[model samples]
Target: MIASYDALSEARKALDTPLFAGLPGDVAVSFEFFPPKSDAMMLQLWDVVQALAPLAPEFVSVTYGAGGTTRDRTHGTVARIISEARLPAAAHLTCVDATKAEVNAVAEAYWEAGVRHIVALRGDMGEPGAPFVPHPEGYQNAADLVAGLKAIAPFDISVAAYPEMHPDSASPEADIDNLKRKLDAGASRAISQFFFEPETFFRFRDRLAAAGIDAPVLPGILPVSNFAQTRKFAAACGAAIPAWMEGLFAGLDTHPAARQLVAATVAAEFCRRLYAGGVRNFHFYTLNRAELSYAICHLLGVRPKAAAAIQEKAA
Candidate 1:
C-alpha cells in the first residue's frame, strides 16, 4: 500500500498537477475570538490558537463580552497570546458601561502588557430590552471611543463599520458619515460587520471613497460554523441573511460535516470575489473553533507552513 501511494504521488508531481493558487503574497488576514468561560472551552481556544499560529496572521484578537462582561477574561486571554504564543494581539475594548477613566485604565494596562492594537467599540447593553446609555462620564459613542483611545496612546485602533447601514442609523448617509467621523477621529481602519453578499462590501467601500473617507476597511468574514446561530446573530446585528443562505442549510440539521462542506464553499467563493475586486485584507470571526475556519482558509488558498521551507526562502 505504501509503495503504491508513493508511486501515485510521484505520478501526480510529474504531471505538474494544477491546483488553485491562493491570495497574493502581500495579502494579510487577522482573526477574532472571545475569551472562554470554562476549562473545556479554554482548552479548545488554545488548541485553535496553536493550530493557526503557523500561518503568522497579522494579529489575533480576543473580544470583550457585551457590556464588558468578560473584561478580565479578555485581558488574560490576550496577555497569554502575547507572552506564550508570541503573537501580536489586538484587544477589544468597549464603552458600554465604563467611564473615560475606567476605559483609559484598561488601555494603559494593555500598553503595559505590550498590546498595541485595539478594536474599539461602543458595545451593546447586556440585556436586549435595555437601551444603551453612555455613562455620564464616559465617551459618547464609537467615534468618541476611538478619539479617547488615541489620546491614551499611539495604539493602532480599528472601529466597526456597517455596510448595510447600522440598524439605529438615521439614514444610510448618516451611517457612512459616522464611519468617516471614526476614521477622522484617529481609527486606523474599520472592520465591517459581516455581510452575506460581496456587493454589500463593494458598495460600502465605494461610498466611503465618494464621501472622501480614505481609511482602510477590512472585510469581516464569519464562517458558518452553525448556520442557525449565525442566522439569528445576523438578524440581531442587521446583517442581511439572503434567501439563498436559508435554502443552502435547509436539511443538514444533524449532518454537521456536510454543513461544513457547504460553508467552506460559500465563504471561499465570497473571498475569491472580494479578492478579485482588489480587497486584500480580511478579518475572520473565528468563533473559537479552527476546523471550519481552517477549511475555509484552505479553500481560499491559505495553508499551513513548513519551517524549513520558510528558512530556506529567507536564506
Candidate 2:
C-alpha cells in the first residue's frame, strides 16, 4: 500500500508502544563502498565492514573511481570481501580508459576470484561538462560493458539509473532510454542515483513502468554524512535538494552530534516512506562510514550478528 513518511512515523511509534510489539525481521540491504586511499582508510573500511556484516546485505559493492582510477584498490577490496569476509561483492567497472580486452580481463579476474557480481557503468568523463569520448578500442557505453561481462561469465550485473536525468543526458527520456539499453544488453538490475524527495524516484519509477521497463530499480540511499559536501555533489550531479532539507540541517553545522542524530532521523524516515511505497530493496552509498548506516539499518530491523561462522567455514 502507498503511504507517506508521516504515516510511517505514526505506525512505527504505535508499533513501539508497550502494548504493540515492534515490526521484526531482517530487511534486505546492500552497501556501496569506495576503495580505500591509505593505510588508515583501509583499517577504517574493515572496521565499517565488520560492523555492518551482521545485516546480511544481499551483497556489497566497491566503487570504481573516475577515469578508471582506483582500479587496483577496487580489485583488492572486492577480492578481500570474497576471499576473507565471506561476503559477496560487486566490483564497479566502467567503459572508460580501458579497451574491450582489458575490461574483459578484469571481469575474468573477478570471476576467477569467485567474485560474481559487477556494477557496470558508462562512467563520468574526467571533467564535468566534457563530452564522453570512448577509448579507441573500448566499449562505447555501459551496454557494451555489460555484454562483455556476460560473455566472460554469468555475472549479476547492476547499472546506474538517473531519477532526475544524468547531467549529460539530453533529457529524462533519453536517460530512461539509456537505462533500458543497459538492461537490454544484459544488466540484471539498476540502482538509481540518490535523491532527497521520494516523489522524484516514484515519478521516475512510474515513468519507467509506463514505458514498459520492468527491471528491478533499487533506490540508492545516501545518508547525509556531511550536509554541505552532499549538497555540492548533488548540485554538480543535477540532483535537486528540496528546501525542506536545508531547513532540517539548519543550525546544525556547529553541532555535530545533533547533526548526526538528525541525519539518522531523516534517513530512517526516507526508507520507511519508500518501504510503504512498495520498495523492498535499498542500496546504501555508505561512503565507508558506519554510524548513520548502522543506526538506519537498526531502525529498519537489521541487527548485528556473528560473522564468526562464515569466516571459519570459508577458512
Candidate 3:
C-alpha cells in the first residue's frame, strides 16, 4: 500500500510540474562529429560548429574512419576546429593497419597542431563483419594504444565503452574487464556507445561500480531522427532499440518535422532520467548535424554561454 501511494504521488508531481523547468543547467556536454569528405560538406560542418559553439561544449571530437581511412581529413577538421572555432578538439586515433611508427607520427602531428586530447580505439576492419587483424607491428588493442599515446605525450584520453556489450566481446563481464584494462592503462574516461533506454545506462553504471571502476563514463546520447538508419547501425553495434520506439516512429517517414520533434522529446526525456540518476555529463553523437542535439541540450537547461551567465547573475 505504501509503494502504491508513493507511486501515485510521484505521478501527480510529474503531471503538475513542467518536465524541463528549473533545471539550473549544471551539466557538462561534449559532441562528436565525423570528418567531412568534400568542400560542400566542409562548409555544412562549419555551420554546424557555429550553431553549437554558443553552448560552449566541453570539447568537440572528430571521428576516425574505419581502417584509418580518413586520417588526413580528420586532422584537417580537428585543426580547423581548434584554430578557427577556438574550441578544444579531440582527434580520434586507431590501431588498424598502421604500424607503431605511423600511428606515433599522427599523434606527433596532432600535438604540433595544438591538440591535447585523443579518443583512442582498436578500430574495426575495413570491411564490416570482418575480424580485426592488428597490423604486424601495430599496437594490439585499445589498452596498448592508450599506453602508446601516453608515452608520446600527455593527451587527455577517452576510450569507448559498450553498455550493451560490444559486438566483439565474448560476454558482458569480459567487456567490463576490457574497459578496466583501458582505464587502468591510461584513459581518463569512457564514452559509452549509444543506447535507447535510460535503464540500460543505469544498469551499466551499477556494473562498473561493482567492478571497482570509478572513472567518469559519459553517457552517449544519439537522438533518433532517422529511426530506420539508426536501427540498422544499432544492430551492428549490439545496441538494443526498444519496441515502443518503433511504434512511436511507425509512420513518420513522410513527416520529417514531426519526426524530429518526437526524436528531441525522446532523447531529452532519456537525458533527464539519467540526470535524475546522478549523471552530470552527456556526450552527444551529433552525426554532423546540430538541430536535434541543440534542441535536446536546450531542454536540459543548457543555453548559450552568454545567456546562461546572465541568467545566473540575475538569480
Expressed as tens digits, the lDDT of each residue in 106-174 for candidate 3 is 999999999999999999986768898899999999999999999999999999999999999999999
Q: Model 2, 1-315: lDDT tens per residue?
A: 335676676556655663213547436788999999999999999999888777777889999987778888999998998776788789999988888888888888888888888999998777766778899999999988888888889998999999999988888899899899999999989999999878888899999999899999999998997899899889778998889999999899999999998998899888876765667788899999988888878777777656774455333
Candidate 1 per-residue C-alpha lDDT over 1-315 given as tens digits, one digit per residue, 9 for 90 to 100: 975686565445434533235333456778899999988999999999988776667788999988678989999999998877777889999998888999999999999988999999988887754667999999899999999888889998999999999877899999998988989999988998999898899898889999998888999999887988998788777899989989998998899889988988888778766765667788899999887667656655676667544333222
Best by TM-score: 3
Error of 2 at 174 (Å): 1.5
Reference-based lDDT, each prediction: 0.83, 0.85, 0.90
Question: Order the candidates by lDDT, highest first — what do you get?
Answer: 3, 2, 1
lDDT at 84, model 2: 69
Clashing pairs in 1: none
TM-score for each prediction? 0.89, 0.90, 0.93
Q: Candidate 1 local accuracy as lDDT?
A: 0.83
